[model samples]
Target chain A: MNSEETITKASVEDIDRIIHEPARLNIMLYLYVVENADFVYLLHKTGLSKGNLSVHLQKLEANGYLEIMKEFLNRKPHTMVRLTQRGRDAFTAYRESLLNILQ
Target chain B: MKDPLLEQVQNDVATEQQYRDGIPRIAAGFFLIITMLLQMNGNGNTFVMFVPLMPTIIESLRKRFTYPRIGYAKVRDRGSMRKYSLWAVGILLLVGAAVFFINQVSPGTIPQENHQPLLLMWATAIIVVLLGIMVFTSRSNIMATLNAMGVVAIANRFFVLGLHRDALYVVMIAFGAFLLLSGLYSLLSFVKEYPVLTDE
Candidate 1:
């Protein structure tokens, strides 16, 4: 392949597909900076609908990128989500890859 | 642009961590006022005993007032607070031990005379530097205001020092008042901004 084609292919392959989506990326970035946060906090920060957030969170959990815990808070159901160790590593690597690609 | 999303996320996190609740500021303001009061009454050393408890007091206050309104999102550096608290306690213990040792080893080795002006100047410098760091990190309006107040307090300290050395208590009172008022304003704004969210 030519240099331009090679660079494009490398960049494409470097991106982590799971975190490439805008919503999921936003979730990851938020979780990356915090130890753990509840669903309401995430919703408030992301400005995403409840259903949309739940769906994305489930996707992340399925991919082993997030851990969602369900508990009772004040006699009400509460969901807390945090990035797993693997998830943090993935995010750091993803960030580095993106920076490399841009450069 | 160089990753606007990441930059924005970082800014949001810092804002959420520092400005989401004014509990720390309120607690700190109270601590300062109490310290000033004690100093004015010739019981300054007595209040140093409370310095080690300040972090725990602040945390408990935050738990009671802040968490209910804004859901908990433990920031990455939140653990560092405990470490700092421990350090504060350690430093206090060391200072106490040193003072006691000095008194025993050589009576009157330590100066009993109040160096209030010099002490206030040093305090002003330290507080300004800390407030400057807060402003640099968060760039929030509240922090900027606090930093400005710190600068003004430092200037006031110098003015008071030059005019009347004995009136150094005024500088402490003024600075404490600024912190108390600013904290009250922030706490009120935070309550209004984020009402207690009912779990759906």
Candidate 2:
């Protein structure tokens, strides 16, 4: 394929490094639909074990893609997540970039 | 303390998953609509009416539509298709036998005026079951399936009822309107998350 075609197609490397992992994508997508979701809901939605999801969520949180709020629900520790404005813009751009490459 | 790269990855995965989840629904919906239309025509034995058509539809869909883009690429295996066919055949036989036994056991229970509508309803039920099967086993798009269901429901209302052609047209138009609205809602939501890119 020509350079143009290559640009249009999201590289395997890009997909592997960025978009292909199972857990993080699920979390981002779920948050995109629901304004905010609790840690428990994320656990259910992603089907990721709590530890696994937590690790991924922390990675995302560190990356500035998400805001994690720690609060008390029923007097128990609860964590809620929401996409930051930057995260939302990045996600939209990333999606279009991927589609352009893939298409 | 946010990682843009990780966040981007998460969004991509979610979008792909949503599309993946929608596949079976789309397939089932298409089958449902086709079977409904066939049933509405009031021809052919119900026992095996859709049997020959299943493979044809799958093949045609695969050939005509690009894979992955329009959700056609997901049907990589024939195993689910075979299972679907077998299940359809078995259910059809069982229904046929039941209908036959019912008529034999109580000949007067089925009034002459109600026979056609009852048959239509039975056919619709069978199609719905088949749709459920597709949803579970196949990788079809959900939006496509919903659209197909809408089409079948509208067609069933018109043809099976033997309504005036004009009335049928009106019903079909209304059905189309509903489908358009629902489709737009789904598209808008999807688009909101993943906006269309334009080269300026």
Candidate 3:
């Protein structure tokens, strides 16, 4: 590849497009720290509507960034979510990209 | 992209770090009351024995009960708190044991009225410092203000107005009971707020 092509490719690769969305980023960051959290917990913390959160969570899960589990609490559905190892790595890469760009 | 939503998540994580637990507060309250009971009997050394155990007990209880429902996340103090906590405990113990030793040797090294105030001062200092660290680390304005009120209350009670030992016990008992009640309230609140979803 030409030098110009290599430079452009590297810059494009730097940004984690999958985690670039704001809502999904927030969810990923929250799960990154807390390790695991309930859907309601994330809903409250993120201040996202139930439908909106479920949508974003679905996207992250599709990308294998997180794992969502369904449990029955008091005979009601409880959704617990955690970032998979792949998700953690992506987050770390994203943070580094931000730092690199800022620097 | 520094947006309000990202900021909110950051703030929430900080809040989680210093988030107060009702049950732990009650455990501390109980520990304070028990310490006061020992003080009432003039049992100095024994108080120390039980004092350190309270936090461990409270943590265990929290893991079993509060964690399953609400979630569990610990603040990463980055080892600063460990050093500060150890130093603070050592200094307080040294001061306490010195006075006790002096009293044993001569029977009145520290006047009876003075010891409580002295302990209160150390406690207030530690509380202020720890809460100050929490304020800085957690970036919570509430903690910044809360410690100031605590310091002033201690000062007013013992420094400005003398409190007899009986009054001291009463004060500690009231504080302890407040903790216990707060814990109960938290427990109830948690149960209501986050009911058990499913065993799986």
TM-score of chain B of each: 0.62, 0.40, 0.62
lDDT of 3 at A16: 87
Best candidate, DockQ-wise? 1
Please give the TM-score of chain B in predicted model 1: 0.62
TM-score of chain B of 2: 0.40
User: What is candidate 2's lDDT per residue for A1-95, written digit by digit as tens?
Assistant: 89876655545435533334667877776676545656765664566766888888888888888998888745657677788887776666666
> Model 2, range B31-60, lDDT digits (tens) per residue?
444444544465425635665565465444
Candidate 1 local lDDT, B1-200, one digit each (tens): 14577666756776665555655556556666676677767776666576567667766766566666666676654333344444433443564467568767987653445345344334433443344233223444345345434644654555545555336556656666776788778878888887665434
C-alpha lDDT of candidate 2 relative to the true structure: 0.52
Would candidate 1 be rated incorrect, acceptable, medium or high by CAPRI criteria? acceptable
Assess the local accuracy of residue B196 in candidate 1 as a C-alpha lDDT between 0 and 100: 66
Chain A TM-scores of all predicted models: 0.92, 0.83, 0.87
TM-score-based ranking: 1, 3, 2
> Using lDDT as the measure, what is the rank order of every candidate, best first?
1, 3, 2
For residue A102, give model 3's deviation from the true position in Å: 4.3
Model 3, B167: alpha-carbon shift in Å? 2.5
The residue ranges of model 1 lying beyond 4 angstroms of the native Cα positions read A1-3, A6-15, A72-78, A96-103, B1-8, B77-112, B115-166, B198-200
The interface root-mean-square deviations, each candidate in sequence, come to: 2.2, 17.0, 5.2
Candidate 2 docking: what grade?
incorrect
Better lDDT candidate (2, 3): 3
Interface root-mean-square deviation of model 3 in angstroms is 5.2
Clashes of each: 0, 18, 5
